[model samples]
Target: MRAGWTWLAAPELWPGRRTAGEVVLALVLGIMAAGSEELLGGEGPRLAVVGIAAVVLSLLRRRMPGTVLAVTAALTPLLSGFAPLLMLVGWSAGRRIVGAGRALAMFSVAFVLFAGVTLQDSWSQQAPMTRLLLTTLYFLATTVVPGLASRYWTQRRTLLHALQERNAQLLWERELVAGQARLRERQRIAQDMHDSLGHQLALISVHTGALEVDPELTPRQREAVGVLRGASVTAMHELREVVGILRDGVEAPAPVDDSGLVGRGTAGIVGLVESARTAGNTVELRSAGEERPLAAAADHAAYRIVQEALTNAYKHAPGASISVELRYEPDSFVVEIVSAAAPAPAPGEVVSGGQGLTGLRERARLVGGMVHAGPADGGGFRVAGVLPYGVVEAAPFVAAEDDFRQQSPKAATVNGLPPMDWTVSARELAGGKERSRAGGIAMGCGIGVALVLVLVVAGGFALAFLVGSMSQGMIDPGEYESVKIGSGEDVVRDRLPNGDTITLMGLDGKGPKEPEGSECLVLMSSDVGDSFETEPVFRFCFKGGKLIEKKSYEVSR
Candidate 1:
């Protein structure tokens, strides 16, 4: 019982189960169609046959939808009992057929066939032109319109799914970026500690070693100095190991300034600018307001921001002039670097990991600061940072990264990177383009359907009016009487008009019952006119290639 319930609850849990469900649905629809036909006075046996055929065709609709649609249309007039099945095939065709051109061709073929069959069956019935028009409209409404609508619905669902998947992928990538940013920040911290604390330990080791060899020191004093030297060396080794763990097995480069004062504070800026100039890059430094002391973390963050900006300028802009500005406001310190744009670099001239700006932003965030980097007003790049004088308690790294991700895109940088003008990946751009294309296709389909509907309605009305004005199928009273009973079918047809006009009046089916096992033809009289209050019609029954009965009747307009 549990297994049965599981299968019922989720039929698609196993292969072929969904197809089985579809087949069951088709069977139910077929049964309904057959029952409906019987209720509407159709022959039970014939309707059952049609229903079975409809079921078979519906099952193949997915694979050969266009072919199935055409076949169903051809059978429509003969099997009016299976109209529901016809509509199902049409809708399936619209959904399965790819591309607008192919769909249009398939629908057009089906529509024409349906219209032709309907006209052939009803041409001799009362008000044939009007009936034809109404039937055509009904066919479009039930079959064509539903099909087009189904196609549109399917497209919308597919586009929505693509957008959802793309959004999910972007969210995953954002989390990955945040993780990478946190790791890089930790490595930066490790490098800073190694430069400063490792240098001090080395100095201590050197001094203790010197004291151990001093001739003036007593034996106990020399022994104490030897122990201190050994401890300092061990501490240095441990520091290296910790730094290695932080850097994830990557070795940190030696500091440029051997004294370890290059990225300490404002003093470091002076040396950094001089070094850039020495490296054949034009550089200028400006300072404003009263110089004040800053928290250790903030000071280091400030120096690093300047160093990264200057390095980027030198690498990317090559010959462009760079300006580093410092403002020591009462509440905060601001550091801004602007570099003019230069000629494009030669192939392979510059290789960048694209992580420098991200690292700067992370460094600033740890010290309660924000960094903004983007294009400047006059064809250049600018990186500006605002740091608090007093260090604030740092937020969790993941939380801080999340805050950056939620920042407005209008800002100069997002998630520690520059604006997306140049940073947007090709894959992201392609996704955007795909969404736009999908929207355009959906709009075009809607417009095309509306246009087709309008054209069909207008044309159908015009044709009905033209057909009503003609009298090509009307017979005079004398010709109707000349068609005697027992006449050969050919002789009777030759005596009658070229065409029949049962469209002058409506049929009630209350006339004399048709002869058993015989075919009948109904025609209009020539006395009928547009202004007539009543119409005269002639009915002829034929059996075994001979006319068996002839009758005349009158119907109110």
Candidate 2:
């Protein structure tokens, strides 16, 4: 029961389940339609069929709007009294369809059907001229008005959805920029700490080893120096591990040695392949073309690219065979690393933090390079990067290093050092052009306002004309003029349009009650020149169903 209620509340939960709002609307419309049927003395099975169809159509209005409208229009003539339900269908169509041309077509088809039904019914009771006028008015009321209102709402809804999506996209872009800035800051800190602290630790280890070999020291003192040298060497390795964590925000399978503390240089690629082989993975390295010289930044980026790829293979494919290839061209250096797929992970194996590939991409992008990583052919993954030769000249790095050297000794401390500007420059470089759409917005609003004004003016004039025509239809001026005193009841009814007679006791507010046994019929008519203005009235008294006295005079407002 709970699941049923949940499905009813959310139509999106499952297909074909009616929403609470739709069920309520359908129920209300069905009941009102049944009332219309009974009012028209439609108590048979035909009315039942129409009522059932209307309810079912209303329930499916959002899903199949055009089909429901077409079926409703076809049934309108036989069930003309069910006009309210049909108008609701027209409203739904207006709100759902987007284009004005399509909406107009739908309204036109419904109008034609409604006019046919109205004309057939009025034909027997009304004159040829009167039937046409009534059919047009009924058509406007049943189809045009409701559909136009729905179209207006549909336009507003579409605009609102677009604005919301744009706003969300802007928010996402802002967060992405902020996150990139933070990651860059972490990388700069890691670089500075590795340079300063690692140098000091290496100096301490070297001096302690020198003291252990000195003949001037006692035997016990020499033993203490040996312990000190071993501890300092261990501390240096641990510090490199910390730097790697700071660079990528994740524990890596291999510690990064990009700081040059290990003296790998351009030959670092060989050591990386050896390390991968040592980690129980089969490794192969291939090189093409002659080796070429590169700037410090480009050299480091190339080395880091190979290092990160090998590290990823170790983490994600532990026992897989790997191939590392480096191609040297006239103006570019390309590296590709491919690894075979490993067995499925064990049940409780440690999961990756997913930052390695992102760091590699950012690293390449900083030096005007690109990296691509994805599944390779035949059940393995491939990581590749292309670094343009001479992309980062020595000038920028040399200038930054010179400025750092100029700072005071105390200011070299990481906490005391000024914030770097290279990051800010990189951010500005990555930010693309931004353009404003104000001109288009202004033009769109102007066009929208003009259309609304046109519709309003047109609707106003149409309503005025229809009201004027219908009012004029009620009282025929020619018939009123033809009625004479002493005319019989049949003559009076024949002169009038609907056989409606208003009994009056006066003419121009001055006469006796019932016209002294000759009942007086007062007929009023509106001036056709203006919609709100009324014209003069005529009174004719009848005796024994025959008119006896007649008078004509204007009635004041």
User: Best candidate per TM-score, number?
Assistant: 1
Clash numbers, per candidate:
2, 2
Local accuracy of candidate 1 as per-residue lDDT tens digits, 397-444? 236456544433333333454432323442343345567678668776
**lDDT of each residue in 12-115, candidate 2, tens digit only:** 45434445666777877777777787887878886677668778877666666676777687677677646777777777777765577877776677667666
Highest-scoring model, lDDT: 1
Every model's Cα RMSD, please? 14.0, 22.2
Once fitted onto the true fold, the runs of candidate 2 whose alpha carbons sit more than 4 angstroms away are 1-28, 59-64, 74-80, 120-189, 218-235, 251-557
Cα deviation of 552 in candidate 2 (Å)? 17
Q: Which stretches of candidate 1 lie over 4 Å from their true place?
A: 1-17, 40-45, 125-127, 161-203, 213-215, 218-231, 246-557
Which residue pairs in model 1 clash with each other? 127-503, 128-503
